[model samples]
Target: MTEKQFKKLKYYVIAITILFVVGFLLWEHLNGGILSHHLMHHSDYPSISNWWGLLILPFLAWLSTVRIEKRVTLQPDDAPVKAKILRVVLIGFFGMLVLSLVQSLSFSVGYESVAICLSLGLVVVGLFLPIYRAECIFGYVFGSIFFTGAIIPLIGILVIAGISWFSHVCIKPLVFRVIRAQPQ
Candidate 1:
């Protein structure tokens, strides 16, 4: 996309994010405050309001869009790869949204195992695709914000990002050096 188009897209995303926050606030107000779970239980800590999303979501949106624009500008020729990444991000966003909805709405089903599996899967993906940190975090928090709230997912992503960075910056080079040192 051209710079002009990216600017327009950024505006649209900002507008939508604002609308979403307003809608969520209204919904929460209408049906009492939305309570956030701590460590997968509502009673483990004092009731935390979902109002945190109002600030966090917009920040994530801005950060992700800026990162995406920079990536597109730096490698304009990688349009196909960029498109694939976009598709994957969108899929992940919606998939997480659905999962969060289900886990929040249903009290009978055990989804802890599923969540653990998905988290592990994302860690593996992040090790290989460390360049999409902003996109991954944005998609994850945006998708799960309604049910999981903002802070928990933000903390989780920060930990994952750190591990991914360590693997990419430290371990990968060490492994490459070891491989090169071995006689064929």
Candidate 2:
């Protein structure tokens, strides 16, 4: 896909993300979780909604490229290559989900430190994974850390969000630049 097409596709994926979040909330509400409470605060375990989101996320990422490819299939493009990238991203998402689940379960069992450490570890792994595979790394790393901090009340959310924003704005690009500069 061309850059313009990719930009359009990003908007589509953003829309899908918004819808996924909304659907998650709806699922929570239907299951009797608080509508007023944030979705992350609604549970101690990885929500089914989250699993659903992760399951579809790869498909959406791949499909966006597929749509563009169908319209413009002439170039010596690497759209097909996106399949592997999205799959790796999906693995990262699944890893985060499992780790978050373990963290939540640990919190319920009064092993909060373990949960935080696991989250911190996941963040570190996420930091490296993006150097090799940038697709959805922010969501993987940030989402995992958020789960770790989610149990810490308001301060936790603020801290994780700050870290995520900082990494996204400052660190990720530098890593990408470094990776791009290295021998292929």
Native-referenced Cα lDDT, model 1: 0.72
Q: Estimate each model's TM-score.
A: 0.79, 0.42
Taken over the whole model, the C-alpha lDDT of each candidate is 0.72, 0.52
lDDT of 2 by residue, 3-29 (tens): 677678767865776565556646755
Off by over 4 Å in 2: 1-76, 131-184
Considering every candidate listed, which one attains the maximal TM-score?
A: 1
- Model 1 segments beyond 4 Å from truth? 39-44, 76-108
- Look at candidate 2 and tell me the lDDT of residue 41: 49
- Ten residues in sequence with the least summed lDDT for candidate 2: 145-154
Model 1 weakest 10-residue run by lDDT: 99-108
Candidate 1, residues 1-184: lDDT per residue as tens digits? 7789889998898779878987987887789766666655657677556788889888888887887777667765778977876676566556555544554334326667667766777678768767236766776677676666777777777887788888899989999999999999
lDDT of 1 at 1: 71
